[model samples]
Target: MLMGSCKSLKKVNTVSIRTTKPRKISPEAQNLYKRLQETTKKGYAFGHQDATAYGIGWKNDGTLFKTDVHEITGQHPAVHGFDIGHLELEWEYNLDTVPFALIQDQIKKIHQKGGIVTVSWHASNPISGEDSWNRRGKPIKKLLPGRRLHRTYKTWLATIASFFNDIKDDQGRPIPIIFRPFHEMNKPWFWWGKGKCSADEYKMLWRETVDLLTHEFSVDQLLFAYSPDAFDNREAYLEYYPGDDVVDILGMDLYQHWTAKSFSKNLNDGLKVIAQLGKEKQKLYALTESGLEKVRISDWWTKVIDQQLAHSGITWALFWRNARKSHHFVSYPGHKSATDFMHLAQKDYVLFLDDIVPIEVSSEAQ
Candidate 1:
């Protein structure tokens, strides 16, 4: 059945495509996906981290295109024990006009290094820019606003699904890509947000996106993650939640505030809620987005994640940034950096490093 669309360009699936031509999924691939979905598995993350909003172009030039990617790759997870690496998406593949093929190779590199890659999407950004991913890095409002001539963004789903198929694993299985669209849903800062979108409206968009991506596009290997910023409380967290079935992975983005009392409470409360939710759903979980703003001490790292993982249903943690002081984005005070979180695995869950494969995470994270 065709999903409903908004009267104007405000329609949930609107997007500015690079080409007017449409693509098709081969019959064999379609059959493979249908069979795969049966055992496709739902993946989850524990203590994951996002690289958005981080400016690292040497001396703050913000041209971080090449330099920052390498730096982030080397340091962030090394300090943290992350199983996933999340990046933003763009109209082009990479620095060159290699299309989406090169991007798939890069994702495989991340996976070869023991982490799956994720590309993010926002509702507002529609214009294709010079950047390799994420509409050339333009804010969604600037790229698209107030509805346009074309009111649907459905084509993007097809584009990404095709990219996923082009990339495969050692066994020839398509590289399972984790696509996180419209993240930080509860945060009002995003253009799709701005404190708008009724629950039904949001759900409609989410469901439509999923239906087109999974059923229509046949990207069965993709994992959908619903990530919200740290909540003030559970009620705030559930406000933008897309519900359990629509989401394969449930995670949150949080940070270490400079303040002692406030940050501590936020961290503790957030972890407590994470544990509860993971157990309730029997899902794999993560502190999806995290880093320290100011605090910096080696022990601070292990303690923070260890405490959280020490809980009943917690899994791995991914810290961000490898630099000291200012670069404490994903690292904690005592943890030294994101890599520091890994050491605590033995002490925390002891079982998270438990099942180290994507298949296991997919099954458990669900």
Candidate 2:
């Protein structure tokens, strides 16, 4: 579905392209990256992390959501989000947690069915053994080079690297994943955030993690994403950036933080910085995580979300999981915003699972 020439501009899936050859990413990732670059300008894909196993009306209950996306909007999300934190720690799989076995199955299905997969890690603090938000003191330093917990951290990476390695398709070729770690690093809530580590220290931590996963562990079917919280300007966004070599995707996580007027302005301003910087560095950009709790605003999907996306040039925007009734991002069937959400889903520029081209894996790889 890719066509055109350099002089007239390249086209993929009938859309104009602006893709760069990836140096460190896998061929599968490179393929998706190119499509995303072209798709953002021509159309934006809708992503909802953990859309099948759970949602607002459900929570890993025995009954799974069946054709609900089609029931609500006649399509499935283009991207599915999953987490491997608990799996890395060897925890049992449950409603709120994921198991390595189940994760691989889910990813394999996504690839086979012509959808994308993005994974995030909410790793616990190695030092304190607390949750990701444990801000006891400089926990990140322990995980860096020559630190007290460095060995343990390496073991942890080995576990994660194994999971990444284990994900394979029917043809046996490794499936590509948009691996986002230490997300919202600019925020102070997480242990790896600005308040817990220096800019240079954070960069080292990021590089070390990538090095361990890519080189030491020899896991290659991954695209690294460096994402931070919302910022007012480019300086703040790039303050703790690792570097161009270690990052393939420039992503931002922003939630509703102001009145309609100021929220849109702040979001657009931050997006402008990311979009411009991503272009300069020849990297893909995405709204890694977004949405208002409960989706109170009736037209939030179209007016608030889609309006900013219209000009942001982001490859995709993924709303957080629909955990339960009280805390949710996407509207379920019968919700007040259900109709509006479908409207956002049905936009001409909005691409869902049915809109994307299916991935083809060679039988030799099996």
Best by lDDT: 2
Q: What is the model-wide C-alpha lDDT for candidate 2?
A: 0.76
Name the weakest run of 10 consecutive residues (lDDT summed) in model 1.
78-87
lDDT of 1 at 158: 57
Q: How high is each candidate's TM-score?
A: 0.61, 0.88
Best by TM-score: 2
- Please give the distance, in angstroms, between residue 240's alpha carbon in candidate 2 and its true position after superposition: 0.9
Candidate 1 regions off by >4 Å? 1-90, 93-103, 110-114, 122-124, 127-152, 294-298, 321-366
Which stretches in model 2 have alpha-carbon errors above 4 Å?
1-24, 59-68, 358-366
Candidate 2 colliding pairs: 171-366
